[model samples]
Target: MPILWLTVIVLALAALGYVIGRRRALASGDGRIRNLHSLPSYYGSYVAMMTGVPAISLMLLWLLAQPFWVNSAVLADLPVSAVADGSSSSLVMSDVRRLADGLDRAVAQGVMTEADIDAMGSDLSGIRTRLGNVGVALGSDVSTDILTSAQDYRTKAATGRLVMSILVLAVAIVGFGWAYQRTHKDFRARNVVERGIRYVLIAAACIAILTTIGIVLSLVFNAIAFFRVYPASDFFFSLTWSPSFGGGSELGILPLLWGTFYISIIALLVAVPIGLFSAIYLAEYAGPKVRGVAKPLLEVLAGIPTIVYGLFALLTVGPFLLGIFGPDGVGWMQAGTAVITAGLVMGIMLIPFVSSLSDDIINAVPQALRDGSYGLGATKSETIRQVILPAALPGIVGAILLAASRAIGETMIVVLGAGAAARLDLNPFEAMTTVTAKIVSQLTGDADFSSPEALVAFALGMTLFIVTLGLNVFALYIVRKYREQYE
Candidate 1:
């Protein structure tokens, strides 16, 4: 059965169980609510939970495991000779899976029958034509061994699905039976249901933590693989960035790191003063009506997609800068796409990150601090600078760090405004690319995964992750130290 159909059946069973369990509890209590230890609804919910949760969990696990099991089985059955020269086993397997899916589509579209497919032999010319008729295109001609493996893959997958449907339905039915039997006037259904909910919540939290661990581990392992082929010292110390899949690629990260920091620092310079001043005005000086309108209007910048900001940089800011700095005037910039263009636009994109967070932090400072400063005959501006700003310093620093991280991680604006050239130049008018942009470039297209050129993306990502982590730690230390002093 299709997963959707299976899900519907399980949910229908759960709903039926809810109604039956509630009626059973009412019947056990002689149709009197007072005799029951818990609410009738709780008994119903308990039945539904048991009937649905286990079956759904099992179905999810089965779905997650099925592809790996099927892939392994089919690969085991496939002979080593099936793979063509200049192609990896993974590529052959990919073709096999595509062929299998194409065949399935052919059958579904009534282009072929099971008998017809079984009668088909090693010759794939006719098969390819039929597959194309059903809009399934293959990269190369299919082989006899590949065809056989694909058929096996399809058969196993269908069988797995059938078995999964049967087992899931069985589990749901068994749960319904058990929970129905347990439904009684004296049962503690509410407590059991609440405990189950708590466990589910705990599981959700664990899943989040495990996912973070999994991401870090993947980056670590891939980076290790990359460093095994390319020297880490070269990657870190060399002041050049060039990757060639052909061979002798310079995988230096220094230029990329320089561009990243250069752009980020420029963005911060543009954003911090404007954002902080706006935050101060909104939080401390603005009337209630002005605050209500201006704050939301300012925060609207945050809601705009980064890609849109990139486009604005590309079409608007870049041209404007070029007209001033290009041949028309100073002759400093050769093109519209330069570091300053991206940096200025990215800084604009980060304004809300700084202003919104800083505003909230500034507002969070105690009014008593301001009052005490004023009591000492300090002016409003003096109170803001000497009392409110100092009290809010830690949170403001945190907000700035968050903005810096945002600046570091930005891709689209950098890609659009700053050209894709990695160079260690001090001139802001020069084109440069950041680590995030280069990571995207390295991983894109038909690159060999095992090659250092391809795997270096992970190394770049790992470096970025470490830098962001360090920034966060520094922010946390500052927050904690000042937080204690303020307290």
Candidate 2:
């Protein structure tokens, strides 16, 4: 069955279970609500939870596990000769999956039948043509071994899905029957349902924690692999940034780091003052009507996609800056793409992150602080400078750090505005590239995954991750110190 249909059927069963359980609870109490241990609604919710949760959970687990199971089975049965020279098993498995999907599509499109597929043993003559008709283009002709494996994969996958559907429906039906039988007037349905909800919440929290752990581990492992092939000392300390895939490459991270920090510093210089002042105006001085109109207009910059910002930097800002700083003017800039271009655009992109967050933080300062300052004969400006700003300092620092992180991670603006020249030049008008832009460059096209060039992307990502993590830790320390002082 289609997953959508299965979900609908399961939901229908749960809804029916809810009505039946409620009625049964009322019947057990002789239709008197006061005689029941819990409310009639609690009994119905308990039944609905029992009917839906276990079955839905099983269905999700089955879906996640099915692909792995199918891939393993197909790979184990696949012949060694199927994988071409210089190619990995993963690539072969990818082709097998695509071919299997194509066969399924071919059947669905009425171009082929199950008997045709069964009879088509290792023949690549017409199979590719038929598959192409259904819009399934393969990189190369299908081999006999690949064809057989795909067939086996399709068969096992179909069988597994069938078994999963049967098992899910069975569990749902059993849960409904059991819950219906247990829905008595004295049953503690509320307690049971609440306990189940607590577990679900705990599971969600664990998933989030586990996901973070998984990301860190992946970066660590890939970076370790990269270090094994390339020298850690060169990667960390060398000032150049030249990556040649055909060996003898210089993989220095310093230039990239320099560019990243240089651009981010410029961005912070532009963003912090403007964003903070705007926040002050919005939160402290603006009238209600003005605040309502101006705040959203300022925040709308945040909603504009990074790509749009990148285009603005590339086409408009870069050219505008170049005209002033190029040969016709100061002659400091050689081209349109430069650090200043990306930094200014990125600063614009980060305005909302700082302004909106800082506005909220400034507003969160206690009104009593302002009144106390006023009572001390302080003017509004003096009171704001001393009391409101101080009270809101911790949150504002956090907001700035958050914006700094966003600046550090920005890629599109850097790619389009900052030319892909990794250098240690201090001039903001000169072209430069960041770690994120280089990460994208390193991983683009048909690069070999096991090669140092490709693996360096992970190393760059790990370095970026560490830098952002340190920023977060510093932000936390500052927040804690100020929070303790203020509270």
Candidate 3:
């Protein structure tokens, strides 16, 4: 049976259990609703939980474990010499899986029978033609060893799935019967169901934490592997950025880091003041009608995809800047693709991020503070500058930091606007690339994963992670210090 059908069967059984459990609880109470300790609905929910949760959990575990068990079983039957020249055991296993699937499809199409496939043995051309007629392509001729392994792989996988379906259904049935038997007027169904829900919530939180840990660990391990081959000192301190697959590549991060921050600083300079001023005007100065109409228009920038921003940078912003500063005019900008273009476009992308958050934070400032400042004979501007801004400073700082992070991590705008030239130059008009752009370049297109060139992507990622983490920590420290002072 397919897993989908099995799921349906378990759900049906659980539904049946719910009905029975609800009726049994009411019957035990002599059909008097007040006689039950908990509600009849609670009893039904408890039975459903008991029937579905355990079976689903078991099925999930079996699904995760089945591949590993079957892969090992199939690998054991594979001959040592089955791995042909310039190929690996993994590659051969891939072929085996493909052939197994093709054979199954051929049988389903009535082009081949089970007995015929079993006896086909070393009939490479014949099998290929039959499989091809069904639209399954094979790269190489089928060998006796591979053919045998495919059959065994198919058999083992089918058997495992069958056993899994049976066990899951059995567990569901057992849970249903057990919970039904326990259904009574005195049974604490509500408590059991509530406890189960709490556990599920706890598990969800733990999964999130574990996922973060796993991502960090993966970065650390790959970075370690990279640094072992490439010098950590050079990788961290060198002012160059070049990667050659063969050897002797100057993989320096400083130039990339400089570009990344240069663009981000420009972005912050553009985004912070405008976003903050707009937020203040909307929050403190604008009339209700204007604010209502204006706030949504400002926030629409946030809803726009980063790719659209990239296209705007490429077609509109980049060309416009170049027209003003390029060789045809000021002779400062050489082409449309330059750091200034990326920075300006990225800043536009971050405006809504800064404005929306700052607006909320500024609005959260106490009305009492504003009134007190007014009572002190301060004008509206003075009150805003001294009272509202200071009160909302911590949250404003947080919003700025969040925008900075987005600016730093932006890839599309940089790729489209800033030309991919890793150089330690000072001119914003000059083209430069960022760490994110370099990471994409290093990993793209026919790159060998084992080489330092490819592995450097991980090291770059880890460096970016550290930089962002430090920024977050610094932001938290600032927020806390100021928050404490105000409190």
Candidates sorted on lDDT, descending: 1, 2, 3
Q: Per-candidate RMSD vs. true structure?
A: 2.0, 1.8, 3.1
The C-alpha stretches of model 1 lying farther than 4 A from their native spots are 84-86, 106-116, 119-123, 480-487
Residue pairs of candidate 3 with colliding backbone atoms: none
Give Cα-based local distance difference scores for all models. 0.92, 0.92, 0.90
Q: Write the per-residue lDDT of candidate 3 for residues 145-220, one digit (tens) a residue.
A: 8888998988998899999999999999999989999999999998998999999899889889999999999999
Evaluate residue 32 in candidate 3 and report its C-alpha lDDT on the 0 to 100 scale. 93
Clashing pairs in 2: none
Instruction: Measure candidate 3: CA RMSD.
Output: 3.1
Error of 3 at 265 (Å): 1.3
- lDDT string, candidate 1, 391-466, tens digits: 8988899889989988998999999999999999999999999999999999998988899999999999999999
Q: Give the TM-scores of the predictions, in the order they appear.
A: 0.95, 0.95, 0.89
In model 1, the worst 10-residue window by lDDT is 478-487
lDDT of 2: 0.92
Error of 2 at 136 (Å): 2.4
